[model samples]
Target: MTFEFEDRKHENTQLPNNLSAPNPGHTHQLISIMNTQKRDRFELLSAYLDGEVTATERRQVEEWLDKDVETQRLYSRLLNLRSNFQSLPVPSAQPVEQTIGQVFGKIDKRRRHRSVAWGGAAIAAMVVAALSSVVPGRQVWQMANVNNSAASEPLYVALNTPVVEIPDTVLAPAHKSAPAQPAKLHQQNN
Candidate 1:
């Protein structure tokens, strides 16, 4: 098989030989084994390296490795890679309270700003409500007292009636209707 190098920098450096066997005589046999193709080769090798492979499969890989130089080179490369990773520097830990307080400060600032905005909105609403109540020819605006249980039913009835439709139907009757008769109440003796 012919080898091709696309990058000039990688031209001289020996690549990780992923080849299963190095022997020239067995090259055709190895190629046939590779081409027959079912499961992944790397996965099989990884399982073998981890000692998770069956005894028969282990024996097959061992026999193949015995006649292989490229497989030996790959094994050395994997060993060096593992060793290099193990030698890497680890990052230092930061204090938990410092991290929490920094995030908490931003949240607190946003909350304070929102509270101030809502307070201003509430004050504006109160001023408009007061002015509307005090204006001449305007009906006296009454808020139902929360402590008065008697007003609760009326409030619910009023809420159930659509405000816009009430003006056309209530207060002033149609000119065609005669004077309304009052309902007579009867008392029952207990």
Candidate 2:
């Protein structure tokens, strides 16, 4: 099979209606130039709106706006935007005391939450420490009485253990107990 490559440069040269297509390079350059001019014009108009332009510059912008319908519409929109911004309600100043109180309240709330979390963590650590120190297969009371003497040993009563009563003679102290009494003072006469 034979293949042929068509020339794109001459494609737009000959048209049925004899109309010439614009050059791609010229079209792009024209567009860029127009955009630059439009940007400069808008800047001038903005400066005019802000009352920063001289009398001559203001006149030039006025003339350009009067001649171009698009520019006039753009300027009208800019004016409307400015007026809308100006008409917006200005926020009133809040009382300094109330603002300070609100700020402190927020700070205090955060501090309280942090303190509560820290307290919980401390309690958890203590519980872990206590459990780790206890010997395996031993009651928590036994751990408490580890340092106590045999005579004053802790009670080993279970949950289901029956209560037993001892006679008064066994319950009494082994040694003689002294009765507590108030002392009387005797006055001496000279």
Any residue pairs clashing in model 2, and if so which?
Answer: none
**Candidate 2, 35-127: lDDT as tens digits:** 756666677777779987766677777887889998898899899999999999999999999999999999999999999999999999999
Q: At residue 71, give the lDDT of candidate 2.
A: 86
What clash pairs does model 1 have?
A: none
In every candidate, how many clashes are there? Answer: 0, 0
Prediction 1 TM-score vs. true:
0.32
Measured with C-alpha atoms, the lDDT of residue 150 in candidate 2 is 73
lDDT of 2 at 111: 100
lDDT of 1 by residue, 1-190 (tens): 0111112223433323544468775677656555433123344455667677766667755775687676666666766877898899887777999889999999999999999999999999999988987789966758886766776655434567666575656577677776445442222322
lDDT of 1 at 94: 71
TM-score of each: 0.32, 0.51
Global lDDT of model 1: 0.62
Measured by TM-score, the strongest candidate is 2
Residue 114 local lDDT, model 2: 100
